[model samples]
Target: MGKLLENHSKNLLREAGVLVPKHVVARSPEEAAEKAAELGFPVVLKALVPVGKRGKAGAVKFAQNAQEAFELTRELLAMTVRHFPVEKVLIEEKIAIAQEWYLAITIDKKAQTPLIIASLKGGVDVEELSQSAPEQIMTKSIDPILGFAEFQAKELWSELGLTGKPLTLATQALTCLVKIFLAKDATLLEINPLVLTENGDVAAAASVMSVDDSAMYRHPELAAMVQLGSERTWRPLTDLEKRMVEVNELDPYRGTARYTEMDGGEIGFLCGGGGGSLLSFDALVSFGGRPANYSEVGGNPPERKVLGITKGILAKPGVKGLFVAHNITNNTQVDVLAQGVVQALKEMGKDPKIFPVVVREAGVNDEAAREIFTKTGVEYYGDNATITEAAQRMVERIKALEISGEGI
Candidate 1:
């Protein structure tokens, strides 16, 4: 779930012996015009935002002279799209593309393998093409342990019907792309507009994307790049996220949490792991319940960490209900989690009668946790309860209190 900026993605491709267009980053219109003049006419001026679809958003423009370059840069500098402000512009020499194609390497979560996706049509939405005409796209999964073999890459090139130098270049590009994907531990590596130049030379006209936050540990350089981008954007990080990042630096082997704050709603979810959290969130949405935030107290988390996480979740405004759901696992202690929840409630000076809470604890020490909840007069569910059932019960309880006009 990590995303790399476009500049960094292009740098990775350049390091793999791919011929990318000569480019320069300009912080102002004057610098942009200078760079465009140095690179010659017909340069592309792109707004340097981390997100994609810049062309569709009018964030990318072409300049045939210095005046157009300056004007475009000035217009883009103050523009913001998708909540991201453009601070810099990339100026590059435009290539004469005779033909275009697409290539990408990414992990398939369902298949648990590396997937290679390519298409004959490029510079457009591949998803749209697939939906309208899937015959133009080619896809294959590769075993990470074996890496991508040369023969497999050759077969893919043949399937695309590319011949001669274009075929050779495409095969080489695929091989190098796979190497970069594996070497960087990237979740996604995409190259759109894998262009064939009018002179029959192959080059990458535009690199679309890449993301490799997991591999930041093994690549200090990549980690530095990530830090730089994060700093530039001035994104606000929650206390839990900052602490988790610090802990990850100290001990890379421990389980991690990906916490992001969202608009507050009625129910607060404390679910287990990624998949279970997503399931509960989707179920709550389907049952007409809005979640306050997405929080996953990972497996075997320390008691103090659990306490801190609970406190953080409860501190948000407009949280009327709480759902503590965990799947069947052997390591985590349910009693410890219960203690954290109880402590957080006490600190907030809130009464269970006013604030409704639902608990669905299963697995290790689940019985003890249920007993604790009972002693405190809190509602609790056992191991066999379905996720939908738990969500429905919470919604019903909240609705009842709403009907009564309770102050929660």
Candidate 2:
């Protein structure tokens, strides 16, 4: 889940040969006014932010003249939509739309396939349309492997009551859009208010797009437009979060190391595996322990990757104790993990004597894992203790440390 801003989304559509309104980027109200004057009055001024519902948030406005454009641009620039402050404005020539339609391509997570949600009605909430008039909207599931064809697109529009030249034009637009969706490995590509101009030409008036972050490796061209790992936050990444991203990307390949900072907590959580991380977090919370940060470290990571993540977890303010856990690994070696954790603790000058550190890992090379951890003077457990029991032990250790004010 990686969302592209409106300007980026429009750029993608234009690159794919889709018709879009003539637009210009403006960093200030004066620039927006100048662009409005150059493009002629009656323009749309939209805030350049990644989050959605800009219209409802007063980030999207219309200006009928240069003066109005200048004033509205100032207003848009002042908005903070979904915690994202406006830094730029997109000024575009307003299209005289005769009709509006909706088209979107996304995944049906439950069905595990690409799906299309299209409707004859547009410029309105898709959810409202679904509830108000379900007959006017159609949901189509796409065969991701075989792909969507031009004929399939044509038939789709034709069924929605489009005919003649409009039908053909809409079909071509849909075909091109589908190609962009699949080729880019996008999670979402939606054209709301896909307008039919008064002159009877089809154009995409607005678009919202998000690509799969896991597939970003295959799309170097998108690097400049996308802020990698932006899917997790509505606002800009905090300094600590940015550092964590650097740590993970520095490795590129070897294993996974992901970290997300929490608001506030006392325990630093370093868990492994996708499922294991979630279970660890839930178990900690269930045992009345607050984790300062959430981390996922797995896939048989090398010492460097493990140490990088472990240090990050413990660096968060107020994190006095560390809780590390992972499920029974299939391929991940517990010894390698133990080495990384111990090295990070030593580098950070953390001693189990003062700082409570609990590790529960049992997998390949468990014997070595136990030995390394115990030698480091860190509390360690193997398969004998369930993950839940390990979580309890970590909580108890932290509580005793807090009572004694040793690490506080």
C-alpha lDDT score of every prediction, in listed order = 0.77, 0.86
The runs of at least 3 residues in candidate 1 whose Cα sits more than 4 Å from the true structure, single-residue gaps closed, are 227-252, 273-279, 282-288, 339-354, 371-378, 384-389, 396-408
Candidate 2 local lDDT, 1-408, one digit each (tens): 667888888988999988999998998889888989999778999998877677888788899998898888888888887877888999999999999999999999999898988888998889888888999998888896898889999889989999999998899899889889999999889999899999999999998888986677788898778755545545677788778777776556667788888889999999887877888899999988999988888777788888888998878888888988888887778888888888888888888767888989888998998999988788988888988999998889888877876754
For residue 379, give model 2's deviation from the true position in Å. Answer: 1.6
RMSD, every candidate, angstroms: 4.0, 1.9
lDDT of 1 by residue, 1-408 (tens): 455667777888889988788888999999999889999999998888766678899998999999999999999999986677788898888999999998878889899898999987888888898999899999999887888887799899899898888888888888888888888777777888788889887777777555555457787777645522222233435555565445334334444433455665778778885677778888888888878877777657656666666776777777788888876756778888788788877788656666888888788888889888777767888777977788888888878878988756
Scored against the true structure, residue 279 in model 2 reaches a CA lDDT of 89
Q: What lDDT does candidate 1 reach at residue 131?
A: 98
Show the lowest summed lDDT stretch of 10 residues, model 1.
227-236
| Model 2 score (lDDT) | 0.86
Q: Candidate 1: which pairs clash?
A: none
